[model samples]
Target: MTANKIIFYPDNKEINVDQGTGILEAAIMAGVHINSPCGGKGVCGKCKVRIKQGRVETKTVGLLTKDEIDNGFVLACGSISLTDVEIDIPTSSSISREQILTQEAKVEHMEGIISRLDAGDSEGKEVFIHTPLVRKLHLTIPLPSLDDHTSDLERVYREINKLTGLEDISTKLSTIRLIPEILRDNNWQVTAIIGDGKLLSLEAGNTSHRNFGLAIDVGTTTVVVSLIDLNTGMIIDTEASYNRQAHYGADVITRIIFSRNKQGLDKLHQLIIETINDLILALINGHQIQQNDITAVTCAGNTTMLHLLLSITPSHIRLEPYIPVVNGMPLINADETGIKINPHGLVACLPHVASFVGADITSGVLASGMYQSDEVSMLIDIGTNGEIVIGNKDWLVCCASSAGPAFEGGGIKAGIRAMEGAIQRVEIDPMDYTVRYNTISEVKPIGVCGSGLIDTLTEMLRARIIDQSGNINESIPSKRIRETENGLEFVLVWKEDSGTLLDIVITQSDISNLIFSKGAIYTACVVLAGKIGFDINDIERIYIAGGFGNYLNIEKSIMIGLLPDIDRDRYKFIGNSSLTGARFCLLSDKAMKIAEEIASKMTYIELSADVSYMYEYTGALFLPHTDMGRFPSVQL
Candidate 1:
């Protein structure tokens, strides 16, 4: 009945587990994060641990070579402790908060974003003036007299009507309670934050200059927030962090499944709110601003994320029919949604196209200006769930594919988000098989990121280290490409050269996962185009939208078949278009209207229902693609 002591090195942290408990389970119970991208299914072969001095039984030593098995290496998930043991948890198996893609990447594009919204173009020449969704109107009222004694609330409403030219405006009970005091104390002078016939708040004095709004991009893995000066349509500050819900699950479907348990939905909801408020608090404290100064917020996320944010039931989003509770949500107050902004501040949840293709994609289309462009264009959001929109001003078609989290460092061994010390770029010398990698901030590589993964795949293919089938070529004469116990892996950085003090490698399994992910994305694009009676080349321009695209090399992306083999000029890396679109809606009601219109105009194509989709996906599973003719530029 005694517990087996499992000592993990070199940290020497010890956790006692029951005799039959797996090493991965013990690690989890010990508050350790091991790379189990397949959710510990024992298929990824990522959680390999060296049993230094342990008596354990392994059901299956997956992907390990004879030497590795002899050296006492076994899959953590496949091994169960039988006696007291000491194990070495390799650096490749640990998940740390060292390097995650957050706010740093957005800073470089802030001015460009501001200029685009201000000038309507990248050149910053012609200014596009527009009204924000939330407007602060200063009002003055005459003292109550016998001749005209109108109620304080009625007087304010009358003035608001005169200013906004609208009838049937609504005010919250919280705003109503403070109306008399605010009017009387300020001598009948006030500023009102009004949007879409809703009086979000009424201030005692003229606080119009201090009015602000938040534009948010609620990504599955990360969340970005932008604080804007609503008065001048300028972004004051921006913040980002990892989504707190990621602890529950990495992707939306996993989250949806996790939310089905008792109190699961509430926990997920609270986590996202906490994540957002943390960012808000950072912005407020850092910039010396008050939460009340923020009058409104607009959030852009997938339907599930949007649902989870509002605590809406997302069980059906994963089940048959895949219908969401609501696609277009009405404006709700911050207090009601538990956002720490002004109690009366409106939280305007943007309209979504469908269950999978939510407001993020819709807002992205609007932000990219593709909704109004006459020429054919496409927007591909590369992430855990890859969403694609292909169309122009006249019409639009969209689809969502399960690309897994390989690109965002979810499933790969030694994979990390785009942060400092993460390898963001990779190049291989064909002659010597020497590998050169660049980290995000020129630090030692802890893991390879999405861009670096693509670069590695392309470079490896070009160097003949891996064939089109994504299998490592053992026949190739290269020390870097060696057959490991867990299959062949190309070592990018040695233990001495890496930040983790463990070799950074991409295994054959990692290559397969990457291939499947990139294949899903590329196939989704091709299938969407084919359904439109157009080839992949027929699209005039392909706009790659995401923060991840900021580090993407168009040639390398195409070389890996993540993107289509089209003219490089036609590829536009519009960084964080979802956030950009949300900001557009935050600053301009017209843009908000356009976002709704884009959502309405888009035709969501469910790939699961399409027969041709599976075929295209199978064909795209190879390097570049099964159809070599499509990728003419790919020499391999």
Candidate 2:
């Protein structure tokens, strides 16, 4: 096949691709970040590029205004080059991996044991003491003598066995080299940081008080790291950042396709490591602690993320049967994984149940305590993918639905990840149709996030600005509801009021995407519940988990049919349950065992194989739902 040379402006990056190649694909291959929130499906219209001196064949230009089409503006994902051409990619159209949502401010809502203990509640204080996966032991040994002379490594191992009363532990060669010096430098008095089967480090002096571990929630859209003091199991601080892998694609499916190439896996692996390293640097610097003081890391994420972190190919994850390399991963050395922590530190990944349902769900199940409850309980983890777990102590069943990235603020015009300047809430006046909203930290609006999108959609439905089908009412007598280049859009913030120069608006297409996302979530819940011979109302409690769940409004979530119409009292919002589960496993051996049990015991139901799931999804495509009886509380 003949190749064509395409030159990108501003950065002046050039790449050669086969004839008829989409510009967005070329940008991806050339290591360029183009913001295509729909993953190059040609629906988002976010990857707008201007042609400088070339002609291209466009499959669809509906996203662009007539003026824009005349002015050489086109959607990169929708355009194919007819010849060698030059194009200008705008900064607004570039994907910013740094914009990931990472604030732990909302973690106060977490219902885990750690949060209760940190609050100093009497019930928690009476129940148990903090126990971490890594234990620190202080040891004093006699100086080298004929009768008592023992190798430094063996001496340390002996002391560890005496303290923990366990045999057959593995030691890293790196720890062996440090044992001789760390033991002798402190006059044979040293602290051994150890886990169940691995020796992390041997530090000089009685450094038992300095032991620490990190609990990470590695979401497809964001990465959250929590620094926990091992001695007390208290979260000292947290750091969150956008996942750098987002530059390749917003969802795991896109990344799975990207990994099919030879260097793609390595590139993704490096990006995630950099993201983790960046968070590690921030936590250490913020706390004024040395990197060596950190002993272990517990990571909770989906199956694909675990594969990418381990530099394993995830191509098969999206294939037939959707089988992954392994649902449960073994302990990996920090150095082997390129994690910027103690060289001998252990990085443990929580086990996953299936390809779609992963460690994050297992962690959420563990954190929610739904597994131990006698009454029926359900968990909904809403993110790029929606994972639903339904059951109680007796039995558990789960399923995953491709909810897309709409809820994470992808696939929408003027949409951004949950960040400081992103709008978190919304209220629309019924009479005037004027919009009122609040941004994170009271910052000027840059874009609307997931919560804000739900609120807006609900309010629009109530105010009659949008119908049950999610179509904008063009006849509405309001300035906020007006037609735009991308069909009819409701303007939330004018150019003067927004942080950016452009007007922040929600389009009809954005509403459609969100509806599809919500429909998938609700359908998954119904399908999982039906599989267990139960109705949605049979759920005694509904636990919402994830970063988006932190700020989620129950009323609005139900109003949009994203959640079931159960009594408000039955709904519980547990912020970042995945991270909470990771922390629980990090601090409690029992919690880790429970996590494994959850992964093994939970039944994974493939929704694609279920014939009824399609009917449920189509029914949920309307505002609230096609069956008004399912959502009695929702009034429109």
RMSD of each: 4.5, 4.8
The segments of candidate 1 whose C-alpha lies over 4 angstroms from its true place after superposition are 1-104, 107-113, 122-129
lDDT of 1 by residue, 181-270 (tens): 888999889998887777877988898888888999888877888888888887887778777676555678878988886598998899
Instruction: Assess each prediction's global lDDT (C-alpha) against the native.
Output: 0.82, 0.83
For candidate 2, lDDT tens digit of each residue in 1-108?
878899887678899999899998888777676776656777667788888987788887877666557778889998898889899876557644344433443463
Supply the TM-score for candidate 1.
Answer: 0.87
| Candidate no. 2 TM-score | 0.86
Worst 10 residues of 2 by lDDT: 120-129
Question: For residue 88, what is the lDDT in candidate 1?
Answer: 84
- Each model's number of backbone clashes? 3, 1
Model 2 stretches astray by more than 4 angstroms = 1-43, 47-129, 149-154, 169-185, 483-486
Q: Give candidate 1's total backbone clashes.
A: 3
lDDT, model 2, position 635: 76
